[model samples]
Structures are given as structure tokens and as C-alpha cells.
Target: MAWIMLLVAGLFEVVWAYSMKQSAGFTRLLPTLVTIVGMVISFVLLSAAMRSIPLGTAYTIWTGIGAVGAFLVGVAVLGEQVNTMRVIAAVLIVSGLVLMKLSAE
Candidate 1:
């Protein structure tokens, strides 16, 4: 349950990030509201997950999920360039996350 909450929090992190972009320096009311709400929910869930999960591990996983999700969103929606190094880096991050999960068990 904690892990699930963490994952949801991480997913919301991506949404908030995208919302921030759409907010355009907070000039847009709707997007700005979305960003604020998303941020609050994301942090609340993250804090709940941290109750059971180690802070270091939870933080790393949360950040990794958000970074990867955001990167993928950028690539898929924004047509961002994906070079060999970027792909390799992403693969490495995934590998590390998998290793961490495996070791935790």
C-alpha cells in the first residue's frame, strides 16, 4: 500500500511538472490551480509512503519514477529528441531501480 501510494505520488509529480509548464509562469489560472493541487496531493502521498519506506529509498524511487515519466512524456508528446546517450541513461536508471527493488526483498 505504501509502495502504491509512492507510485501514485510520483505519477502526480509528473502531472504537476507538466501543469507548471502549462501554467506559463502562473499566468494561467486553471493550470496554476492544477499545479498547486497536484503538488499538494503528491507531497501528501509521498509523506504517507515515507511512514513505512526508508526515506532514502523512498525519495530515490519517487524521483526516479518522476524523472523517467516526465522524460517519456516529453519524448512522446513534445517530440523531444532521444539520442543514444539519453536512451542509455534511461536504461541505466531503470536498471538501478530494479536492482534496488530486488535487493529490498
Candidate 2:
């Protein structure tokens, strides 16, 4: 349950990040509202997940998911560049996330 909440929170983190970008520095109303709502939900779920998951592990995983997810979204949806170095960096982040999860066990 906690992991599920954490995953959802991480996803929300991505949503907020993308929405923030779409918000045009908060000038846009709808995207800004979506960003605000997404951030609140993400933080709430992260707080709940923290009750069970270790702080370092949860934070690392949360940020990792957000980072990689945002990268993918930027590439796929926003037509951002996808270079070898960036791909490798994302892979390293995912590897670290796996290591962090393993260490938590």
C-alpha cells in the first residue's frame, strides 16, 4: 500500500513538473491550477508513504521517478532532444534507484 502510494506520488510529481512547464511561469490559469493540485496530491501521498518507507529511500526514489519521467515526457510529448549522454544519465539514475530500493530491504 505504501509503495503504491509512493508510486502515485512520484507520478504526480511528473504531472506537476510538466504542468509547471506548460504553466508558462504561472501565467496560464488552467496549467497553473493543475500544477498546484498535482503538487499538493504528490506531497500528501509522499507524506503518507514516508510513514513506512525510509526517508532517504523514499526521497531518492521519488525524485528519481520524477526526473526520469519528466525526461521521457519532455522527449515524447514536448519533442525535446534525446542524446546518448542524457539516455545514459537516465539509466544511471534508474540503476541508483534500484540500488536504493535493494539497500532498503
Candidate 3:
């Protein structure tokens, strides 16, 4: 249950990040609201998850999800350039997360 909450929190991190981008420096009202709400929920879930998961591990996975999800969304929706090195870095982040999760189990 805690792990599931962590996963959902990680996904909320992604939504918050994406909404931040869309918020246009907080100039856009709707996106700004979404960003605020998402961030709050994300943190709430993260705190809950931390009751079971180690702080360092949970934090890294949360940020990793946000980073990778933001990068992909930027490329797909915001016309950001896709580069080999960027993709490789994202892959490495994911690999590290997987390794940590496996080791935890």
C-alpha cells in the first residue's frame, strides 16, 4: 500500500511539473491552479509513503519520475528537441530507480 502510494505520488510529481511548464511562469491561471494542487497532493502522498519507504530512496524516485516525465512531455508537447544524450540520461535514471526498487525488495 505504501509503495502504491509512492507510485501515485511520483505520478503526481509528473503532473505538477508538466503543469508548471504550462503555467507560463505562473501567468496562466488555470495551469497555475493545477500546479499548486498537484504539488500539494504530491507532497501529501510522498509524506504518507515515507512512513514505510526510506526518505532517500523515495525522494530520488519521486524526482526521477518528475524529471523524466517533464523531459518527455517537453519534447512531445512543447517542441523541445530530443537528443541522444538526453534520452540516455533518462534511461540511466530509470535504470537506477529500478535497481533501487529491486534492492529494496
Evaluated at residue 97, the lDDT of candidate 1 is 77
What is candidate 1's local distance difference test score? 0.89
Compare the candidates by lDDT and give the number of the best one: 2
What lDDT tens digits, residue by residue, belong to model 2 across residues 8-102?
99999999999999999999999999999999999999999999999999999999999999999999999999999999999999999999999
Candidate 3 lDDT at 104 equals 73
Stretches of candidate 2 above 4 Å error?
none
Pairs that clash in candidate 2: none
The number of the candidate with the highest TM-score is 2
Better of 1 and 2 by TM-score: 2
Q: Which ten-residue region of model 3 has the weakest summed lDDT?
A: 96-105
lDDT for residue 46 in candidate 2, whole number 0-100? 95
Ranking by lDDT: 2, 3, 1
The number of clashing residue pairs in each candidate reads 0, 0, 0
Query: For every model shown, what is its TM-score relative to the native structure?
Result: 0.93, 0.99, 0.94
Candidate 1 structure quality by residue, lDDT tens digits, 1-105:
999999999999999988888899999999999999999999999999999988877888888888888889889987889999998988898888777767666
